[model samples]
Target: MDERRNRMDDARFDEEIAAEVLPLNRDLTLPENEKPRTGREEEAHIHERKQDYAGIGKVTGIAAVILAALSLFILPVFFGGAAVVLGFIARRLGARSLGNWAIGLGAVSIIISLIFAPFF
Candidate 1:
C-alpha cells in the first residue's frame, strides 16, 4: 500500500541521515575526563635548559683556565689555545655566558702562565 511505502521510505531517510551525521570516531563519543597538562612539565623543561646552559659556561671557563696553565708549562707559546678552542665551541653551542667566561678566564690564565712560565 502507498501508506506503508511512505512510512518505510521515511524510516530509511532517517537512518541514512543518522549514519552521515553521527561521529565516526569512537574517541569523540567518550567523555572528556583528562584535563590539560599542568605547568609543572613546561616549568621543569625551562629550568633544565637554564641549568644546562649555566653549567656549560662554568665548566668550559674552568677548563679553559686549566688548559692554558697546563699548555704553557708543557708547550712553547701556545697561550690561551685551549680557551680559544672551548670559547669557540661555546659560541657554536649558543652558550653565551660560557663562551664569554672561557675567553676571559683564558686571558687571565695566559697572562698568569706567561708571568710564571719564566720561573718554571
Candidate 2:
C-alpha cells in the first residue's frame, strides 16, 4: 500500500511540473506576427530632454572673464567685484576652466588696485 501511494504522488508531481514548464517553452516560440504586448514599446518611443549645466556654466564663465577684463579699464573695484561673484557662480554651475580664469583675472585686478592705492 505504501509503494502504491508513492507511485500516485510521483504521478501528481510529474503532472504539476509539466503544467509549469510547458507553457513557458511554448511562449518562447512565439510567431513573428504575434508580438507580445509589453508596454516597453511605448517607453522606447519616449524622448526626454537631458539635463545640461555645462553650456550654461560655460556661457556664464565667459561673461565673467569678459567682465573681469573690462574691470581693468572701467571700474577696477565694481566690475572686479562683479567678475569675482560671476566666477564663483560659474564654478557652482559646473564651468571649471573659465570660472578659474575669471576668478584669477578679477583677483589680479583687485590686487593691482590695492597696490596702486598707496602710490596714488
Candidate 3:
C-alpha cells in the first residue's frame, strides 16, 4: 500500500541522513592527522564505522519505526521504547553506532508512544 511505501521511503531517507551526519559527527574533536595514519586509512576507518552504525541503526530504527507505524493501525501499544533509550546512551558514550541512532529512534518512539499511550 501507499502507506507501507511511505514508511519504507522515510526509513531509507532517515538512514541516508544518518549515514552522512554520523561521519561528520564522529571526527568533530579529533585532529586530522590524529584520526588516521593516512588519508586512505582514515577514510577506511570512517567508512567501516559508518557502515557499522548504519547497520545497527537500521535495525533499531526500523524496529521502532515499524512499531510506531503499527501503533496507528493496531493498538498503539508502541514498543521500541527501550531501543530508543539504548540509542541515547550510545550517543552519549561516543558509540556512534548506538548513540545517534538511539536518539532519533527514541524520539520517534517517545512521540508515537505519547500519541498512543492514551489508547492503552
Winning model by TM-score: 2
Best by lDDT: 2
Per residue, candidate 2 scores C-alpha lDDT tens digits across 1-120 of 999788865634343345443343323465566455567764553322112677788899999999999988878989998999999999988888888989999999999998897997
Q: Write the per-residue lDDT of candidate 3 for residues 52-102, one digit (tens) a residue.
A: 766565555555445544444454333445555555545543456545554
> What TM-score does each of the candidates earn?
0.36, 0.56, 0.33
Candidate 2 wrong stretches, greater than 4 Å? 1-51
In model 2, the clashing pairs are none
Using TM-score, rank the candidates from best to worst.
2, 1, 3
Q: Looking at model 2, how many pairs of residues clash?
A: 0
What's the lDDT for all of these models?
A: 0.63, 0.80, 0.55
Question: How far is 43's C-alpha from truth in model 3 (Å)?
Answer: 2.8
TM-score of model 1 relative to the true fold? Answer: 0.36
Off by more than 4 A, model 3? 1-36, 73-120
Q: Give the Å shift of residue 85 in candidate 3.
A: 4.4
